[model samples]
Target: MEYSKKTRSSPRTLDLNHIENTLSIILSQVEEPLPTITEIAEQLKINRRVLSRHFPVLCHKIVTKRRHYMRMSHLAAIEQCCQEIKEAIVSLQQSGEYPSESRVCELISNPGYFRYQQVRLLYKQELQSTLSSL
Candidate 1:
């Protein structure tokens, strides 16, 4: 009987912020133009052969083309949206309620960040509108 070979687990987890900061540093080091794969991995201390495996988790692609490097932009958009949500939540604190649940439901059903194409759109509009009417 032949003994089966065991494979070792590779590097599994990396801090998201660390990876983004490394990418920023790598991008900055180049003069306006983007750096090559080797340069990015070198700055980030990530192995070029396996770096692609880690990126999809931390950075969702905003754009991609066959010849161009993939563009990831979801983080900024999500972060900005979250900040606006927090502000709306704070405003609601003074009042007893806000129409958040309904609006959120609508948003969930439709699957879009903007509600009626308004920036920082949130479900609590009904609550706010109700308060204004009183």
Candidate 2:
């Protein structure tokens, strides 16, 4: 005469078209940082494994796109840091001052750029050029 009251939760429904559209929108962005597949799945409130299973190709594309974007962004940052170092050295030379590492670090927009090996090499080359020309 007693009845159980337990109810099972229903599985989530996914709209494949909506997921594709959302992914399209994200991929269309030129400047925004690309999200990883896990991030996309989290944003869509789906489990990562489920999303990967449902959209394996899209997931792969997202990973590739993110990789390319990250590489380009890093290259751009390196170029910018090199340019900043070059400008700082030139300014110091024009002002009749030696471009010491400390002085260059103070003049550049980001002193942290010195951590980059590429920037450091460019700085050394530019310094050598300046010294040779004097």
Candidate 3:
């Protein structure tokens, strides 16, 4: 399973929420058949290995009869992330940094956001666990 050096050089600027939301929806549809990683990566225009390397939670999110697929892990990791996001929203509201609820909403809705990797960094235990699997 040796990886090429190019896989190591990609910039970590992917939209985390887009990944999160996409995975969330994929997992939410329990009864429907889902696309393979190859399909997903192709649709996203990202390298399959790169996407897999960047987000190992996809492993936890898959499930299959033959053990090749993944299923979302029913754990506190996602819930914890949502809590952090909520708290950050509250802080932003109190600071009044961005005027208008719609503006704040727009900021939050934009996937190209700052501090996302920092937030990911904050959940080191969860991230580390997934990275170890990778």
Candidate 4:
């Protein structure tokens, strides 16, 4: 009779807490310029597939929510910039100086200054309509 040896393979164990902590660190580090998932995974010394497996919902939700929050923050910043432009125009008017496009562009220093101008116009229109209805 001949005896055969059977080999068993051990299953890979995942540390969920470690994964969550790594994810938290990645999310917190994302600021003005956001890093791609691949970049983040590479930074963590892991592959995207492994990351997605451990944090499926988090993989999508955290990035989506962070992007949404960043957009909201950008909008708020534009609104604040528009308000400052309005104040600057008022100040220029008081000083008997005409507020020109070149002057505004130079003062604002934002390439999206025109968009903020539109926001300011819309805000004024809304305020006027509300006041008229009162």
**Which prediction has the highest lDDT against the true structure?**
2
Predicted candidate 4 versus true structure: per-residue lDDT over 28-110, tens digit per residue: 66554456567767877778888888788777866686678788888887877777666655565566666555555566656
Q: For each predicted model, how many residue pairs clash, with residues at least 3 apart or on different chains?
A: 1, 0, 7, 0
* Candidate rank order under lDDT: 2, 4, 3, 1
lDDT of 2 by residue, 1-106 (tens): 9878878889878898998888878877775579888898899988888867977887788788999889988899889888989999999999999899999999
TM-score of each: 0.30, 0.80, 0.36, 0.59
Assess the local accuracy of residue 64 in candidate 3 as a C-alpha lDDT between 0 and 100: 47
Candidate lDDT scores, in order, read: 0.50, 0.87, 0.53, 0.67
- lDDT score, candidate 3, position 40: 72
Residue 35, model 1: lDDT of 55
What TM-score does candidate 2 get on C-alpha atoms? Answer: 0.80
Clashing pairs in 3: 61-70, 61-71, 61-72, 62-70, 62-71, 63-70, 63-71
Clashing pairs in 4: none
Candidate 4 ranges beyond 4 A from true positions: 1-17, 24-36, 120-134
Q: Which stretches of candidate 3 lie over 4 Å from their true place?
A: 1-12, 63-134
Q: Which ten residues in a row have the lowest lDDT in candidate 1?
A: 58-67
What is the per-residue lDDT of model 3 for residues 53-92, given as tens digits with 9 covering 90 to 100? 7777763565342133222332244445545545545565
